[model samples]
Target: MENFTEVLSKINTAKVIAPQIDYSDYVALDLSIDNEELAQSNLQNAKEYELYIQRFLDRNKAKIAFGGYLETRNLYQRSTVFKNLNSEERNIHIGLDLWINQTASIHAALDGTIHSFQNNTALGDYGPTIILAHHLEGFTFYSLYGHLSVDSITNKNVGDVIKQGQQIGNLGLPPINGDYAPHLHFQIILNIESNFGDYPGVCNAGKLDFYSNNCPNPNILLKIDNNT
Candidate 1:
């Protein structure tokens, strides 16, 4: 059997969000801690994030702003879910985020069965999330879709069949989407262990090594090429 990373690299996937939009229309957006622009701007709430993304899209002349796998960010400061005095601040993002203001459709990246679904109601959590288990080339792995609208998990069940490019849900609005701008937090897990609908999408530097291996860059599956 091939290694998980090799298997993922060999697989191809459809656009996991808003399939109608062309890949060429996808522009990269930087919300990382190193981004001077994000540091300079005061993005207070979900509504502000919406406006910020809109401006970014308009300025870039692109339909969507995407990126942020393994990128460190300061945006999580507002929520205790990411930080507390006792815990190492989880500031690094482990999943790729596809951003757009509208409630765009979310799709399955590959053929799989629903592994789990949940509405993590914490202030800065995944909100509505879904995990899919897939087998390819004799390797079993999982895919997670987060920041989805409430309706997404409304009637989902474990082990339900999901097809490649199938519409699974819609991008959630702010507050419902962990109070951030609308986006789909997509991740690939080589070993899900006992994690259900939720997994650590963000981690601190100390835990980066393990997470970097367990959760490979989603682009390996997205085939987005150098995190375009």
Candidate 2:
């Protein structure tokens, strides 16, 4: 029997973002805690993030910036959901984030049925999110699309049959999209447990082992070169 990672490697998936943009146009973005540039610069708000992302894209000559699977970031410090006096700070991002200044079309990564959808309206939450259940090679897994536009989940229903590459929604703007710049937070989960439309996008250092195993790097399915 193969493990979840091995099983994921067997399938060829479609682009979760619009197909019009080629993978060659993608550039790796580092929001990790170690990024010196990000550390020196102050990126506290959505507008600031948008500006920072745009400058990076302009310099790299890329259409979209993607990365951040299992990367530790300091951007979540402003939200109480990520840290407080009581709970462990969850700064380690567990999903692949695709960033773009404009609102881009979001697509399904594979053929699957909608497991759940909800508008998580917390200060730094996934404003509108969708989760899909996929089955392959005797394994069942899930993909989450977060920071989506409100209309994305407006008419969507549970168990909605979604085809690979189908347009599910568009990237959302700030305040509505958890107060972040326009971006798609994509993650893969082996066991969703009792999670409905939302899942932990970040984890504390102590729980890193378990979360990493449950949520593998989304790049395994995206296959985009992690080149900056």
Candidate 3:
């Protein structure tokens, strides 16, 4: 069996995040819905996460920001079982959420063509999303960016090549951004069988193992934290 790590290691390091954005403009939000306080936590507490993102924007208005790792969540994974719990309940989060108050210019982390894009209009859905495909390190992978402004895909077509750090879209606001807060849902995918526009940002308890491996830590390629 081909190990996923082997594929990741083969990714073209030179092409990934070449025009890296400053971390000062972005903050980490919930990555998993593992904790009760945050998992079942209401949107009111979104400020905590939003604020973190805002601070990054406040410092670097012109630069892009990034964060939201496994440690970004209250729970260990993103599971519906957790979401079914009460506010004090612990849940898991699956995606890395990048925070920025207004619609910050979203860029492609690498050179890739648009695989799919859609407006996932749902209370907790991605609202607006885009997925790109790229071949790196002898392996092909996909990157999903969620909670984007509806206009982002106004005239974009599938297979369109987006260069690394190229402005692809901007962030959307609440009510349109899944009602959580203003932020972007960024995820690195290995084999995306189908789930277009939106994937399981949160997984069920039974499939934890599957998701953990299928969706390797995005920071591995993003290298968001150079200081650490």
Candidate 4:
């Protein structure tokens, strides 16, 4: 059996957002615990966090801020959803986040069918989410789009076919999008197991190996060279 990375290389390079945005407009953002600016700021609320993101984009003269795959972030401390009673907190992000304006059109990375979707209503959750099942070279996998507006999943049914670059939905606002800054959390899952519309986008330190293997870096398909 081919490993996930090997199979991912065979898929076409994709752009999850609009094509008008130049690759030069994409800047790498760091929300990890080591980021001094994030540590000093008051980011407990979505609005404040949104402003922080705005400042970063403005300073860098970029339209989109990306990164966060497998990064350990301090932002998750605000939500208990990532914590276990006696276990290590899940601070490792497993998805690639693209920070952009609310209502920005989201695109499908490849041809797939709607596997599942739901509105996760928790304070810090996915809000409106969608999962698409895809196949390439006889191997099957799944793609997850989180932090989406309700309209994205509305009127859509399971098994709906989604073509590459198809408009899947729009980026959601705070409270509606798990109360965080507007962004799309895109993840690739090798085995969804029993997860439906939602899957663990963050993982505990000890389980990093497992999740990292199951969920490869989305950049493999996005092919985003943030340094540009």
Candidate 5:
């Protein structure tokens, strides 16, 4: 069995990013569904409106890159807009988002092998997604890159070695990247539990505790604060 403490301690050596578009950018806004009280309101349209703003941000990502660990939008359970969404889509965002325009180069966070890759096609899905497996300090973990362009997985194969900072893939565009906006839904998993090319990015309020513990913050790996 893998010890969680040792895995977390090794995080200090893991490659990290600022979680922003670039170094000089400041936080613009944050949106998250963690707010229990506000979630009760008929905020379905409000969430949609936020997507529109996110689309606008996608259009101008080159100029206004996202940074820091942000709670970037609100999602409600009553709204079918997000209700009908798959397990991977429901329960609002469960990871940090690195907002940027299309085709930004995605670098691997560590030396790992391609565990799996797929083009998850759906209105609001990961489009072209990739998962990398890493073994460190006697523990195994996976990293997921969603909203990637199709070209990213064109010649990729399982078990292929991906060095740290290698260009894993390019960001996908609207209609292909889950219909939300152009950004990277970067998440880390302690145990994939057999899911491939896709994992739960959102979880219900009833199950937040389990998901939160299983999916530790990517910021631990990104370590953005030290970079500045």
Candidate 6:
């Protein structure tokens, strides 16, 4: 069997969001430790961090603020879900984020069936998340859409067929979307394990190798130009 990464390399029709966004409109955002701007700002709050992202997009004249795969973020410190005495802090982001306006439509990256849907309402967690099960070229994988509006999972059911580019839901606002900015946390899961509607989008430093292998880079399917 081909590895998940190799299978993704052959895919040419993965659209994680609306197709109207052109390559020129995408701005690669840096929230990692390398970004000096974020290091100086107080990004503990979701709203405040959201404003920073907005300012960046506006300043760059771009519509989307993207990137953040395996980025070490300090913002997760605000939520106990990520940091606790029982375990090490989980700050490494394992997905690609698309920072756009609130209520923007989210589409299926590929043809798949709804595996699970739930409103994972916790501080700094995935709100109204959906997981899609897909099979291509004898490979089975899953796609996770997080930080979605409440209405997104209202009528959804398990095993529901979803076509590529089909409207899955819209991006949720703060508080509803785990108290963060309106953005879609899109991740590709090679193995979902026992997780239901929610999966770990962030991992601790120690588990980087395990999570990195389980969650392949979403850009392999989206094909978005990180250089842009």
lDDT of 1 by residue, 1-228 (tens): 678888778777888999888888889888987888877887878888888889999998988888899899988999899999899899999999989888799999999999999999899899999999998988788999999999999888999999999999988987888988888999998889999999999999999999999999998889765444
Model 2 quality (TM-score): 0.97
Ordering by lDDT: 2, 1, 4, 6, 5, 3
Which should have the higher lDDT, number 4 or number 5? 4
* Candidate 5 residue-pair clash tally: 10
In Å, residue 95's CA in model 2 sits off its true spot by 0.5
Per-candidate Cα lDDT values, in order, are 0.90, 0.92, 0.65, 0.89, 0.66, 0.89
lDDT of 5 by residue, 168-188 (tens): 888777666665556678887
lDDT of 6 by residue, 1-228 (tens): 877788887777645676677867899999888788889885777778788988999999998988999999887888889998999999999999999864588899999999999999889999899999999988889999999999999888899999999999988998999999889999999889899999999999899999999998899888787336
Instruction: Report clash pairs, candidate 2.
Output: none
lDDT of 4: 0.89
Flag clash pairs in model 5. 16-222, 20-66, 20-67, 21-66, 31-71, 31-72, 31-73, 32-73, 124-178, 125-178
User: Any runs in candidate 3 off by more than 4 Å, and if so which?
Assistant: 1-21, 24-68, 71-90
lDDT of 3: 0.65
Point out where model 5 deviates above 4 Å: 1-22, 26-28, 33-82, 85-89
Q: Using alpha carbons, what is the TM-score of model 4?
A: 0.95
**Which window of 10 residues has the lowest lDDT sum in candidate 4?**
10-19
Best candidate (score: TM-score): 2
Q: Pick the candidate with the highest lDDT.
A: 2
Point out the worst 10-residue segment of candidate 3 by lDDT: 10-19
How close to the true structure is residue 23 of candidate 2, measured as C-alpha lDDT? Answer: 87
Candidate 1 stretches with Cα past 4 Å from truth are: 226-228
